[model samples]
Every structure is written in structure tokens, then in C-alpha cells.
Target chain A: MSGLSKKQESLIKSLYTRHGRKKHNLCICEGLRCCYEVLNLNPQLVEIAVCSEDFDLSTLPAVASEINFIRVPQEKMKSFSSTVASQGVLVVAAKPEFSKSDDAPADPYIFVLDRVMDPGNFGTILRTAKSVGLTELWFTAGSVDAFNDKVIRSAMGAQFGMTLREFSDLDVLAEELRRFGYNRIFRTTPHEGESCFTAPDLFEKTAIIIGNEANGAAELDGSLSLTIPMPGNYESINAAQAATVILFEYVRRSEGGA
Target chain B: MSGLSKKQESLIKSLYTRHGRKKHNLCICEGLRCCYEVLNLNPQLVEIAVCSEDFDLSTLPAVASEINFIRVPQEKMKSFSSTVASQGVLVVAAKPEFSKSDDAPADPYIFVLDRVMDPGNFGTILRTAKSVGLTELWFTAGSVDAFNDKVIRSAMGAQFGMTLREFSDLDVLAEELRRFGYNRIFRTTPHEGESCFTAPDLFEKTAIIIGNEANGAAELDGSLSLTIPMPGNYESINAAQAATVILFEYVRRSEGGA
Candidate 1:
């Protein structure tokens, strides 16, 4: 939580340090939706901090048995939080263990992003990816951390119930997916050839690859290539948007052609 | 423009205001790509603020032109910006103008949003819309201000050299588009008529209506008369992603089955 106070400043600065946050094993969620969604999805919240007096908490899920709530502490709370207005609630919860084995669904529709650097893009893609029937997500080769504050807020807790995978190469996983008959790979570009709308037809088992914002692709070493259908002045879509379109195309296809 | 000081608070606050930003006629791009792309696009940048004493701007465009360089008076600059650590460069420029009417292209591939509240999603949509032939954009009554700081930063300058219409009504515009021979209209939903991928052969005139984040098209009277393409999940694609996929389908059809 943040407030307009010196004490709040010290607490927040302390929270910024990994050792401090890790010791508590808790991080903050400042935005409304991220905080609310996490509360809805995870029944393990230890405590919550609300900085704005106008916040209504009666609707939130029951807190863990021993937990108690903290008041916004008036002008002091804003200093502990990042968003300008604080959105009425700021939460501190023990970070959930993100396990690929546990969180990855029985049949997963996942988003695979590579070297995507923009936090906002990363966040927006998560929001979009989730809306499109994606229940799992992975990042590789220098993509921004999903736990990064902006990503967590942007994902709207979509990540809360999903498995997140991080690795440089997923040859083993790809092979496994292939064995499960889920390995039709698609790459996005504005260049000619296969259009993304047709992507759903290629595989019930599919992986959509979106590259860095600036560099389209480093190598397609072991992936099938596809491009979104673009007919415009710009040559490419931003990484997140491209990923969202392809992922949804697969979902739409799986839904029997939406 | 924000940095910490006894006084940079007002400067940071200025960022949240359209009038204040316009009075100064300058806006800031906080992220790496927003800065790099501004340099790559060469859009009349006034200066690049570098914070560290050892920071270098040598490889950026037109280093010869003498960018108004400043090694951050560190404390004040950090107070003036949004990011945790200042990248040092916040390009300040007169907000670009979208003429709306000019030597506009003969026929425009455009996407219109009714009211998308999320700035990041709005930006991603603009980015994707641009990539997929939407060179002109219109925001209907419920839409957030397109030039608001969040939206602009989100757009990543995709609006550079393009036109935008604000507070317009789809009913009036759709009627006008019909006069121009753009009669095809498509809507997106999770339970609906065709699959977004294969339906509505997109060779002719088309206008896609993407509703807001919540209760899409509910606020806009009569827009629901339009047919929607249903997809896999019970939930629909995020509005922006829905727009991107639907717009691209048009492009695929126009390509003569290539």
C-alpha cells in the first residue's frame, strides 16, 4: 500500500528490494482488476492493503482464516503504492508458486512470446491472450518477466490460474506436444504466404510464435511459419497484438470456426 | 517530463492532463521501444534525457544534430518520470496531428472502436489495426480519448501520419460508409453465427464494430443488430484482439485466394 507519507515511503522502498519482498514472500497488486481477480482466483491471500478510503471490500472473497485487513492509513497509503490514484485497494499476498506441471491445463491453449521487451505490450497481450481461450502461457529468449508488476496487472489475474513456462528452447516440450498431436507451429509476419485466419485449420495442436518488437524472428529452426493477414501501410503488428490474433485464431478454429 | 525534486510533482501531474500536455504541446514516451521507435521514425524529437553519468546516445539517429543532452540531475529527473530507473531519454514533441481529411488514400481500410477503456489494449489495437490495413480510425462516443497519454503511449506512434475521428456515432457513419460502397459489417462474440476465420468473405466494403471492455455494445443502442462470429471460449476475445482478427480476415479474402 502507498500513502503520502515518509513512513510509507520507507516501507515501499523496502518493498522494492527483492530480499525484503522475498522475506515476506508477498508482493503488491495496485490496480483494481489485478487485485480483484487474484482475490477471486486465489483463496490463499494472507493480507490486503487498501490506500483509498472509498474502497469497498465486502465483496472480496473471505480472507484466509488468520488474516486481518489494513486500513488505507489516510494520506500515508499513496506513498506505498505506485498508481497515481491507488484505485481504492492495494494488496500484499504471498506469491503463488508458478509451476508448469501444475498450472498447465490438461489441454492447453497457450501463448508463446519471444524476446518481447515492452512491459505494456507484454501486459496487453496477456489480457488479450486470456480472453481468447488461452489457459497457459510461456516466454523465452529474453522476454519480459511475467511476474514484473506491469505484466501482473495487465494479465488481470489470467496468469493466476494458468501455468507459466520459461526456457530458452522447448524442444523436449515441443516433442511432447507433438506426441500429443499438438505441434502445428505458426509464426506471425506481414509478409506473404499463409494468413493467420487460416491458422486454426493447420493444427488442433498449435503453437503461435510472436517475436521481438523490432526483430521479426531470429530463426525458425524447428517451427512452421505463418503470417497474419495484413494489407496495410505498416509492415507488422506489435508483438503482443500479433500473438493475440494468432492465439485467438486457433481458439476460434477449435470452437468450430467462429 | 517527471522527475523527483521538491517540485517535479507538478510536472509529473502534467502528464495526466491533455490540456497541460497541449499547453506545453509535448508528450512523453516512457518505455524503450516508445523511445527507440521515436528515434527510428525521426518524428521531430526535441531532446533525449539520459540519467547516468556514463550513459551514451551515440548510436541513436542523427547524433550529429545535437540532441539537447542532459545527464540527469538524477533525483529531479527520476521524480519527473514514470519508470523505476530512468532510461534518460523522454522524447518531447508537439503531439502529432491526424488531419482526418486531406489527400487521404482513395479507399481506406479502417477500424472503429466504440469505447475501449484500457489504454494498453487501445494501443495494441491501434498497432494491430495499422498492420492489418486499418489506416484510418474512429472512436465512437463511449471510447476513451484517443490522445490521452495512456492511449498515445500505448499506440507507440502508430498514429503517426494517420487520421483519427473522435466521438462519432456508428449509425451515422455506417450509413455514410454505405454510400461509399462499404456495406459489409461484422461483429464478434463467443456464441454467434459464423466462425471469425471462415465467415463473411471479405473482398468488398467492410466495417467492423468492436465494443468496449465490458458489456460490449450494450451502451451503444442498436449496434447489436450486427451479426457476430462466435469463438471457442464462452468469453469473447478481448475487444482489440477481436478487431485485429476480424480485420485481417478481410485482407485474406482480398488477396484473391493467394
Candidate 2:
């Protein structure tokens, strides 16, 4: 109670909300593993909050000593944590800034996430896309905030490394990316699309659109679509699972010498 | 207050635990959607529990009328539910019986889940396995129970349609499957394994082993391992996401005709 003041506590709590995160320009990373990743990446890290009695800062990486941090009681960490489970370590960092890069490839393969509401699904998609070597990620306005704590936990630090772009209108963003030489913007659909296994010319510059959890993607005029051929009668797979299949298919087609 | 007897409430809650489910030889299906799936699948559906006031029995399929059911007040339903967000509908069904048919084909591609713990990840693997035309699913001991409420929700009803077998010891299970004519047992690993993209003879009677969340699969002597080539520096992808990529790759290789 004496270590973290009421003002600091309120500030930490505010970061859980989109409005507060935007106003303060901060992102909160919880759990020891994720905090370790943030410290290792060393990307605009502000401070780390830890349980005063139980947590030993020396156990963390050497870079952790270079950053500003605070120690609070275990109960305080629990009270401020947005997740159901807290790992007693929370890192406050300035959100990685988003901007168009000059060195970005002319015909890059980007991922356009459309209104993916679930934080876990959004985070998994980020991790999967990054694993497949996707350098750039874009999202529509309605999707979950990329910096949300749950998303950061699920993403496992890909959010820190990838170049991210947020757009208010997808129609405008599609046109801009197409002009920048992103040739294909394929909206993933559960049906009425070409099978990814047999689709031709998959090596071209592409932007695969991953949709919302329940509603799927918004209709984008003139855009192509792709489907993972499902042999069973199950209604649908999870959004993250679907995105993983599509992203890997892109990689397979591009690199398999097909 | 008298709508749902105390006996019924306790009975429903008991199914939440693995011991209770095993003793009763039943599984609990939570949420309206999952309950509907259980009714439609008609896989030994025992009974359905509904909120007394708001639930309309007629909205369910005609086959629902053929099953035993009970109606309880909304609060009673809440008390019996295991999930944080209960949908006020629960169904009790017999545990799906597992057996290898005598007429089974010589070469069958199976998914051997070795100690996958996360319910959400386990469920996603089930749905993906089913989507890719895999009918036989085997789980080694120490994995999360397949009928768990979280697994049931994430699986989106795949559990109702698949043939699931739980084995106490994986070594024994592997030997049995081998004797049953499963020629290849490929354990999925993160490194130093055959690349799925260029791997030959993928269509053979194969069983892909997906490992645990934290630790990879237990090393099985003489089992082949397959790796998904990752171009990034990230540690690894989610267990279910990795499994999905691998499952779809098998589909692509065997059927794509590339």
C-alpha cells in the first residue's frame, strides 16, 4: 500500500481500457514470460510492476535493471490485473508506434485483420502470421485493439516486433495497399471460395483478410476469397485456426516451388 | 424455488469433474449451441436441462422430444454450470464409445494427441482434425479431458462426431496402433525434423503426434517427427495452430495433385 500510490494505481488500471491506453500512449504486459519478452526486446519499455515481497528483480534478465520499475504487494497486482490469471509481473511500455516504412517491399504479403473481436484469437493470429514471416500487419478500426493486455499475452511478443497499421476504413486501405503493389487482397470465407490447395499463382504479392469471430469478414468489392477445404460437417473452426491454415498455405505455395 | 430439486442440481454439477463424469459415464454439454449440437448428433443423448421460463422446447429439433429432459429456473441453471459465461442450456450425453472396427482400412491417417493440456487448444485440434477428414483421434494420458466444458465449446461440436480413444500409456497405444496396421507414427516437433513442405510419401497410413503446450511430445522410440519451417526468430507457435498447419499440409500433399 505504501509503495504504489493511488495515482499510480489508477494510471495502471486505466491502461486496460482503449481510451486510457490511447490517451496515455502506454501498453501493459502481464505475466513473467511476457514481461521477460518485453525486456528482451527492449522496445520503448517504460517501467515494470512486480510484487514487492515475492518477486526478485535480479532473477530477470540483466536488461531489466536498466529500466524504471515499481514493486507492489501481491494483492495490488491482482487488483490491477485485467486478466483472470496474473503472473505477478506487469510491464508498462510505450506502445510500439505504427507508420509506413520506406524500405517495405513493393509487393509484400501483408495480413489485413477485419474486426477480429476476441483478444486471444487476435493474438494467436499475430503469432502465427509472424511465425510464417509476415513482416507487416494491418487491421480495420472495428477489430480488437492490438495493444490490449490479453492480446499481448497470447501474441507472445510478436506485437513488439511486427510493423502494424491501423485503418479507419478498409476500402481506402485496400486501395492504398494495392497502389503500393500489394496485388491480391483475398478475404477468407468459410465457403464459396477456391480451395487453397489447388489455387494457382499464390506467390504474387498478397494481403490475406482474416475476419471477425462470429460474423466473418465484411464484403470487400472486387476482392478474391479463399477457403480451407473442410471434409467434415463441423460448423466452423476457430478464427485463429482458420487464419493459421491460410497463412501457412500462402507460405507453402510461395516457397514450395509450386 | 422448488422448480429444480436439490438432487438434480447436484447431479448436474457433479458432471463437471472428471471423476464424476467417469463414474456416471456421462458428459456435460454447456451453452445453447453445444446443447443443440448434442441433440442433432444424437450420440447417446441422455437428457437436456433448460431454463424453465425463457427456454422454448419447440425451438429445438424434433428429435429433442425423443430424449429425456428437465427444466430448471435460470438461477438453478447458473449454479449447475461450470463456465464463467453459461448460456442457460446444458445437455447430458453418454461418453462416446471408442472401438477399432474389424473392417477398418489397412492404412488410416490418425491424430495422436500426446498430453495437450489447454482446453481451448485441445478443442481447436479436434475441430481441425475433423475438418481434414481424420476420423480416429487418440489422446495419451495426462491430456485434458476431451469432454471438458471449455474443450466442448472450443471444439464447436466435433467431439460429438469423432472417434476418440484415451490411453493410459502412449507407448502401449503406439504399439497397438502399429499392430492394427497404422504404418507411420510421426511425432510433431519444433526442430531437426523433416519439413512438411518437401516431405515425401505423406499419404501413407500415418498418425501425426501433437505435443503438449509447454513441453513437446514425449520422445517415442522409432517414431518419425515433422517440423513446420519457421523463418522467424520466435520460440514456437501455439500447439493447436501448429497442429492445424500440419494437418492441412497432409491434406494438400495427398489431394492437391501438385
TM-score per model over all chains:
0.72, 0.91
Model 2 lDDT per residue over B81-183, tens place: 7766667677777777665544353325777899999999998898888777777678889999998878987776678877887787679778877877776
lDDT of 1 by residue, B131-200 (tens): 6665577677767756565676667666664567664566766655566665675544446545555554
**Candidate 2: regions farther than 4 A off:** A56-60, A82-85, A100-107, B1-3, B56-60, B65-75, B82-84, B100-107
Query: Taking the tens digit of each residue's C-alpha lDDT, what string does model 2 give over A157-235?
Result: 6788777887886797787777778878788888768777777765467777888888988888888888777766567
Tell me, by DockQ, which candidate is best: 2
TM-score of candidate 1's A chain against the true A chain: 0.80
lDDT tens digits, residues A53-136, model 1? Answer: 665666555552234445555465666555666566666666777764533345453456777887766777776766655556
- Give the distance in Å from residue A182's predicted Cα in candidate 2 to where it truly belongs: 2.0
- Which candidate number would show the highest lDDT if scored against the true structure? 2
Instruction: Please report, in order, the local distance difference test score of every candidate based on alpha carbons.
Output: 0.59, 0.77
Which of the CAPRI classes, incorrect, acceptable, medium or high, describes model 2? medium
lDDT of 1: 0.59
